[model samples]
Target chain A: DTAVSQTPKYLVTQMGNDKSIKCEQNLGHDTMYWYKQDSKKFLKIMFSYNNKELIINETVPNRFSPKSPDKAHLNLHINSLELGDSAVYFCASSQEERKAFFGQGTRLTVV
Target chain B: GESVGLHLPTLSVQEGDNSIINCAYSNSASDYFIWYKQESGKGPQFIIDIRSNMDKRQGQRVTVLLNKTVKHLSLQIAATQPGDSAVYFCAEVTGGGNKLTFGTGTQLKVEL
Candidate 1:
């Protein structure tokens, strides 16, 4: 079974449309994170939530918002998606001070 | 503003050879370090990690070394195989939260 899972492995939409990516972890970890991998393959942390508490928010565009209903679920919603937003999104979770496990990743394509 | 960066952007090696990927961090406060393997169109999978207190840690066929003095980190994979061809990245975490600063990454190509 997948430890961390993401939905819609590939998303293609218009530049001004809205979309969301969902992620879940079955490992029962308290911490969940979202990372964006650019076309250049540089992965950067966007948001991380510890026990449903908002923490580690990068300077991502306000158009992109992350919501964590529970410690096991962290989702990303984008408004007015832009061309620059075309990239891969990954979900990860870890125990306190422990190694993180990642999901299969979702590739978002904004045209 | 400090970030983890890699020395080489890409490397190629014979399938049976060894692979060493280097990373340099700018944050001395970083207390945790990890190495990840990312295949094409896939997420980054954790390979190994080492805390600032230790200099080396090994798992399976991979080894992670942390040189806190130089703010440098490295990952070594023994007997690189064709399945080892992927992008490797080093990550650093300074606090207890889940935030992680990742290196630019080094693409490893294993030639058979």
Candidate 2:
């Protein structure tokens, strides 16, 4: 079974369009996070949720929002995806602040 | 934002030799650290982690060492193989449930 899974491994869209990426984990972790890997392969934290509560929301654009319906799922939605938004988005989880289990990542490409 | 950095952006080692990757972080308050290995076209896989209190931790074929005073971290892999060729990243986590800052990553090329 896929431990942490993300849907649509590749997404191609136009600028000014809205898109969303879905992630789920079966590890029964209490915390989940979203990270962005830029072209230079720099991974940065975007948002995080703990027990379905918003925890860390970095200087991410307000156009991007994260929704966690429960402890096992977290989704990222972008209002207007620009070319600069083209990057690999990863979903990860950790229990009690241990090692973070990450998904394969969703590669979003804005055309 | 806090920054994690790697001393070498690229490293090449022959197979059967050992590999060592180094990282430095600017945040003194950071206590938790992780090393991730990412193969081309794949997500990063957890290699190992070291807490600030611990100086060393070992896994099957890897060892992570941390120096809290200098905010330095290193990962050593024994018997490096061609399959071990990948980009290794070092991440730092503060005392929180989230927020992991990753370095630019070191491209490890294991020569056959």
Candidate 3:
């Protein structure tokens, strides 16, 4: 079984449109994270949630919000999406400071 | 101001040969380091990891070396195969938690 999975592997939307990506982990991990990989293949941390509590929030725009309903799920919602939002969004989960397991990633294309 | 970066953007190696990818980080406080391999249309896969206390760690055919004094890290692969061709990234974690700061990936091409 896939340790971590994200829905809508590919997303294509117009600018100003709102979209959401859903992530779930079956590894029983307490910490989950959202990372953005640009065309240059530079992965940057966007948000981190530990046991349903927000812990790390990067300099991302206000349009981006992450919600973790429980320790098993973390979802990302983007509002007023701009063209710059185009990139591959990855979902990762880990136990404490251990190595993180990543999902297949969702490619978001905002035109 | 803390960032992890790669020295070479790309590396080409022959099959059955060894390959080395280098990374540099500006964060001296980082205690944990990991290397990830990403293939096309897939997320990064955990390859190997090392802590600040250890200078080297080996996994399968991959090895990770850390130099705390210079804040540098390297991943060495032995007998690289064509299937090993992918983009590799080095990530660091500081102050614990799950926040992993990844470096710019290096494309590894294993020629058959």
Candidate 4:
């Protein structure tokens, strides 16, 4: 079974549109994370949630918000998506300080 | 600001040849490090990991070397196959291991 799963393998939307990506982890991990991979293949952490508590928030724009309903689920909501938001979004989960398992990413393209 | 970076953006190797990818980090507080492999249209997959306490750790055909003194990390693959072609990333874990900082990826191309 896929340990970490996220919906919508690919998304394409026009500028100023809003969309959401859902992520769920079955690894029973306590920490979940959202990462953005740019066209240059640079992976940056956008947000991290530990036990449904916000732990790490990078310098991402307020247009991007992450909500964790529980330790097993973390979803990303993008408001008024801009062209710069075009990239791959990944969901990951880990147990404390251990290695993290990642899901197949959702490629977001804003035209 | 703490950041992790890679030296080479791309590396090409022949099948059956070993490959090495290098990374450097500016965070000394990071005690745990992991190496990940990402194929096209996929998320990064964990390959090997090493803690600050150890200099080297070996997996099936992968090896990760950590140099805490210089804050450098390296991942070496033995007998690299065509299937091993992918982007490799090195990540440092800090903030009590809750936060993971990833370096720019290195694309490995294994040619037959």
> TM-score of chain B, per candidate?
0.96, 0.95, 0.97, 0.97
Candidate 4, residue B49: the lDDT equals 83
lDDT of 2 by residue, A20-103 (tens): 999999999999999999998998889889999998899999999999999999999999888999999999998855488889
**lDDT of each model, Cα atoms only?**
0.88, 0.90, 0.93, 0.92
Q: Candidate 2: what lDDT?
A: 0.90
Residue A95, candidate 2: alpha-carbon lDDT: 84
Q: In candidate 3, what fraction of native interface contacts survive?
A: 0.71
Candidate 2 CAPRI category = medium
Interface RMSD of 3: 1.4
Q: For model 1, which pairs clash?
A: none
State how far residue A16 of model 3 sits from its true place (Å).
0.7
Which pairs of residues collide in candidate 3?
Answer: none
Ranking by DockQ: 4, 3, 2, 1
Model 2 C-alpha lDDT per residue in residues B5-111, reported as the tens digit of each score: 99999999999999999999899877688899999878888888877789999998999999888888999999999999999999887856356788999999999
Candidate 3 positional error at B9, Å: 0.5
Q: What is the TM-score of chain A in candidate 2?
A: 0.97
Docking class of 3: medium
Task: Name the lDDT value of residue B46 in candidate 4.
Answer: 86
- The reply for model 2, stretches above 4 Å from the true place, is none
Count of steric clashes across candidates, in order: 0, 0, 0, 0
Q: By the DockQ metric, which is better: model 1 or model 3?
A: 3
